[model samples]
Structure formats: structure tokens, C-alpha cells
Target: MGNSYEDECRRSLAEEQAKSLAGTNNWEHVDRERVHQDWDVLYREITPFLDGGSLPGDQQIQEFVRRHFDIVCRFYTPSREAYVGMSLFYAEDEAMRAFHDSYHPGLVEFLGAAIKVFAEQGSGFAPSAGEASA
Candidate 1:
């Protein structure tokens, strides 16, 4: 009845991707097209088990999110690093807060990973020292 390690990982990945996409500063408009493409890629890669045309169950959804997170973090080759960071950062937007919050226990790990990736990739950004500690 609780979230599994895998589930948590998936959720974390999604959350991280979302936060990174959102970025630290508010922008007039986020590139929805790019976001959708990135999400599509993640969705296709994870192939989350959906039920009744929706995510399987809270537990299953969590697992799917975790798996996607791992893939986003681990799949980036040196050449694709920039794109991966950009895609993950684009995922973090106000519109997605609800989607991220839907999962209980939250996907903090995903958010953390995204931040780490963004920083490491030199996405022309950095979380504040406090945020970095977070």
C-alpha cells in the first residue's frame, strides 16, 4: 500500500525534470512544444502501466515516474547532455505543479536530480547556495 523504491525514483525523476524546466526565474512563456516532446519521449520510454486510460494506481504511477527519472538522468550521452538538461528544465513549470503534486510522498528526488543535472551541465543557471543545499 506504500510507494516502492522504484516508484519513488520515477516520481522523483519527473519532478526533477519539471523543476529544472521551470527554472529559477519566471519567464513570459515556456516552450510548450519542447516540453511536450520531452514528455512524449519519457512517456514512450517508460510505458507506464495505465488503467482505464489513466495511470495504473497511485503506486504504479509513482513507479513509472521514478523509472522515467532514472532514464533522464542516466541516458544522457556527452553529446546529448545539453539537450537533456534543457528538456528537464523545461519540464519544471507552474502548469506542471499539479501533475507533480498528484503523487503522494512527492517526487523530491526527481527535483533534486534535475537540479543536479542542470548545474552540472552548465545550463547557464544555478540554484542559490541555499537552494543548492536543499
Candidate 2:
């Protein structure tokens, strides 16, 4: 059989990611391996909560979201809007969703909601409820 559609999508998304990051000086100094390592750890750390059916606003999940924000900060500081926008992208972008979900099913949606909750509460710029849903 020819390459499956999911494989093709993965290839296309890889290309798109490379193209988007190409020639961006801001990303030049990023420790990509470290970022990948951190992401792997984050993925493993969060999967259990998802598997256990915890809501995104759960305290433990929000803690992971804080770690996620810190990981992003390794490259650049993100305003609250930027953080929420990134979360939306994770949920809405096919490529990003595919990439994240590769580690665990439904990870994209879970992470997105958790990130939104974090952005609203613990991002250090906004003040909101600690238990609100995304």
C-alpha cells in the first residue's frame, strides 16, 4: 500500500513546522534537544491525569501547565494572549494536534484546556479562579 493519509499529514506538518521556524532569529538560540526532552517529560507526566479522567482545571494538571509555560519561556516570554493563542493553536491546528496526540490520545485537547486555565489564573499576569474550566 502507499503511504497512509496520516503519514502524509505528518510529513506535511513537519515541512510546515520547519518552514515556519526557518530564518527566525528568535528561535536560533533555542536548545531544541532540551526542548524535546522537556516536552517528552511533560507528556509522560500529564498522560496519567488524562487517563484518570481529570479535568483540565485540576490542581495537578494546572501545575503541569505552569511547567509548560516555563518550557515556552525558555525560548521567549509569552504574554497571556500569546499563551492562550498557543493553546488554541494546539487544539485547532491539525499539525499541532497530530504531533501532540501522537504521544497520547486526546492530549491536545487536554493540554489546551489546561493551558487556558493556567493563562487565566497562574500566568502571573491575570487573576481568576483556580478551578474554572477552559
Candidate 3:
């Protein structure tokens, strides 16, 4: 009796999540595929820069930052203000923070700074509230 209600609630939550993802670009074939590929590709581009030391405004770093910017825009289509709010969530949301931090010791902080640079200078700086993905 005690466990039945909890099980039903869990099932309901799972069903809701499935429905939500099913209707979004998040789970749709093309966008999900693109994001997965870029996830790896971007990591490759940024990892070297992360290890190389400073985020100098060289062509490569700029390009790396640009990719990040474009991906965010492509995903979130956020206005500038929404982008800042999303960045705050990325930094503060415990689950997101844990996911980012797991990548490296200081990856969360590094990405925060990098995102700032990307938004502040990149041509596609618009951010939207519902656009950002995990």
C-alpha cells in the first residue's frame, strides 16, 4: 500500500518527461543528432584550449567560442537577456553544475567565462528562456 502510490507518481513523472521530450527538438532526430555530434566536436575544440592555458582571442579560440555561441543560438534561440538568465541556471542549477563539473575540475567555471565571452562579442548573441539545452 505504501509503495503503490510512490510507484504511480514515479510512473507519471516519467510519462510526463517522455511526452515533453517527444515534442521538442531535444529528442527529435535531426536536432538531437546534431547536438550529440557537436557535443563531442566541441569538446575536442575546447579541451585543448582549456589545457593550453589562457583564452586568448586568437582565431582558434574565437572559432571555438563561436561554435559554442552558434550552438546555443541554434538550440535556445535566446535573446541576450534570456541567455544571461540561462547562464545563471547553468552555473547554479545543482544537476547542471554537477554534470559540467564532472567533465573537469574547473570546467563549470571555465564554461561560464567562455559563455560570457561568446555572448558579449559573438554576432549571434540572442538568448531565449526556453531555448537553452542541458
Candidate 4:
């Protein structure tokens, strides 16, 4: 977030990475209809956490993150490493961050934390709040 060249470069790189992923053949399965329908369900599920009515690790939140992780697995690889990388892009990429924050302040950060926790639970790895996002 600093004004350094490295920061902007990171943002730009992550944006391109996200674009590349979305442009892949698997993205065909993620049509507008599917996105809209899934968003409806996801929106309902994530609202409480996003609105501060619940915490990040709440059962609903865990389920939401699990569903989110499943979506990513469906579209792409199931590697925890890849999921972690995607979370980085979601939080660090300028456009991705803006899109998620449009839903709520710190939503991307919270989502990143939740996703990383969900992925690492099986591996017994624990990450700092923004470290996975970073």
C-alpha cells in the first residue's frame, strides 16, 4: 500500500495473474447465470460476517469459506498453494480488492483470512490475518 514502485508492481502483477486465471478454459463453466446464482447464495451466507454481526471463524463463516474454496477447486486446481496464491491476488490486486471492498470494507481481507484458514486446517498451518492475503 505504500507509494513505492514495488507496491504498484505487485498490484499490477496480481491483476494480470487474476485476468489470466479468469481467461482460462475452465472459466467457461463460470457463466453469468452461474455467477449470479452463486452470488445470491454466497451473499446471503456472507452477510452476517461482512456486516459485523458475526466473526470470521463463526460456523457460517467457515461454511462460506468452505463453499468459496470449493468453487475455486471446481474452476481450477485444488492445491492449497494455488488457493493461497489466489487469495493473495484477491487481497493485493487493486481491482480485485476494489471489487471485494465494494461488497464491504475489509471483505477481501476477511475472505482471504478465512480462505487461508480453511485451506490450512487440514495441514495444521496457521497464518496471520493478512499474511495469507499479503
Q: CA lDDT of each candidate?
A: 0.41, 0.71, 0.58, 0.62
Better of 1 and 4 by TM-score: 4
lDDT per residue for candidate 3 within 40-121, as digits (tens), equals 5776557666777866455676677667667754544545444444555567779977866666656666776665566567
Q: Which model, 2 or 3, shows the larger TM-score?
A: 2
Query: Candidate 1: minimum summed lDDT over ten consecutive residues — where?
Result: 75-84
Give the number of colliding residue pairs in candidate 2. 0
Write down the RMSD of all candidates, one decimal each: 11.9, 10.4, 10.9, 7.3
Q: What is the lDDT of candidate 3?
A: 0.58
Instruction: Using TM-score as the measure, name the better of candidate 1 and candidate 3.
Output: 3
Writing each residue's lDDT as its tens digit, candidate 2 over 51-95 gives 898999999898888888888777655555556667666777899
Q: What are the models' TM-scores?
A: 0.25, 0.72, 0.60, 0.63
lDDT for residue 89 in candidate 1, whole number 0-100: 38
lDDT of 1 by residue, 71-123 (tens): 44443211123333433434555555445434422333344343334434443
Off by over 4 Å in 2: 1-24, 125-134
Q: Which runs in model 4 stand beyond 4 Å of their true positions? A: 1-26, 122-134
Q: Rank order by TM-score, top first? A: 2, 4, 3, 1
Candidate 3 weakest lDDT stretch, 10 residues: 5-14
TM-score of 3: 0.60
